[model samples]
Target: MIKSRRKLWLFVGLFFSVIILLTLLVAPSRNQLMSGSTFGVAPDGYAAWYEFMQERNAPIERWQKSFKTLQQNYSDNSITLLRVYGKSAQFAVSKTEREWVKKGNTLVNLAFQGRVTEAPFSTSHETDFGAVKIETTRRNTDSFKAILKDDFGAIIWQEKQSEGKIIYVTTPYLAANAYKLSPGNYDFLANLLESSGGNKILVDEYIHGYKDKETQEIEETSNVFAYLLNTTLLIILIQGLVIVLILIFVYNNTLEKKKI
Candidate 1:
């Protein structure tokens, strides 16, 4: 009788475990959450633009790893896209990224703070695009700055280096899922990409907590267990304990009955 009860509990546990595993597998990955990648469908994500680029057969790739890793894999000719929000530290550019751009590649960085510590440009004007606002700047007098209509200065600006070019935008809403629908926002991005003159485009995903291949497996494993423990393990363990206690009580009562 005890053995049968144990088997039943084991089956129940396995069933729930399978269900949980399936749910997790079907759900969005942590890397996709709030990430501006093609896979991410979040409000702040750039899924729309990603798909649009795909449909147009534009050379766009989501770099779901460290900038160092991307630097190693992609050639210097690839155009790298990076968007920073809140604090610049959230998506800090390293020496690898700077060198990559310096080696004749284009780097488009859109920041809410309108600053890149490693490479700074001088501000000239500010502009509004419907609900979005942007501050524009240029590296030199010859550097490009997109003008909207005739008066408003569009947030887009460019700085030409000896080998490469650095384009900075004050706001990322131009490419975000919510604002990309606007014609002005869409046109601005189209023009920027055209002027960059690169066949390969790499959108940085490291800011969304994506790690390099070497550390990804370990971090994912640890993160999953930690998430389960924090969110569901307490209740699951309590329920399991109660089940075991009830089973013990029932088994004891059965033994007492048999003896009596």
Candidate 2:
């Protein structure tokens, strides 16, 4: 009985140890998306940019609400930076946001395709990062015609709507972790920010599926196994019952052996 009990405990300990090892090894590689919240450390995440801003003591805010919601609380002295990956079908900057931008607050929306409804402009070029080039647009109004391109001279143009600006880049890789390593790409981003002339910058995280504090909380709970254990009382109760049963059985068997 003693040997069987010891073996059972050994198996349980090994099971838990394996679980811990797998969690540590696998968790880091999961749920990471490009253009995710700047807080994430994934290769596609903007964590590097977040840390860079912090190091520079830049007055930056991560806006986790929808564009409409953010416009409701918009400030004229700040610059809004919105990055959209994949397709631009579902993302829309509300008229309120446009009105907010028209009030002299700069809004920079970076995406691969489509312009804000307020600015009806399109680019004609291939998406090539190997040879990046840029040019100023001929229809430039309020300097919105400025175009960024690859070395291949593909036009990545900028469009203007009132006082706000919309920049359409071929790829988001310029700000991504792997591509930001290039000195030219890094300088391009720095120049873009410097030109915005707003000390206060707000980055939109809502479009990346992290819409609010509640969503963030859910992500944290889902990622951590310790959180799961703490929140599930039934599992704890079952574990306690199993332990109690094992102890009771061992005690009763010992008592019976002594009588023999």
Q: Please report the candidate that would top TM-score against the real structure.
A: 1
Q: Backbone collision count in every prediction?
A: 0, 8
| Residues 1-260 of candidate 2: C-alpha lDDT, one tens digit per residue | 67857865875675566556655654433353334457656655667866776776767778776665565665654565656353222345567666776666666655443222223233333333233222223222233354554233333456565776655554444455554464445446555665666666777766665567765676576777756654447545555666666667667767877988
Q: How many Å off is the CA of 165 in candidate 2?
A: 2.0
How high is the lDDT of residue 176 in model 1?
69
Cα-based TM-score, every candidate: 0.54, 0.52
Q: What lDDT score goes with residue 102 in model 2?
A: 68
lDDT of 1 by residue, 161-246 (tens): 66887776655555667655554465457556755777677676666655558658756778867657655565566557756665
Weakest lDDT window of 10 consecutive positions for candidate 2:
132-141
Model 2 global lDDT (CA atoms, 0 to 1): 0.55
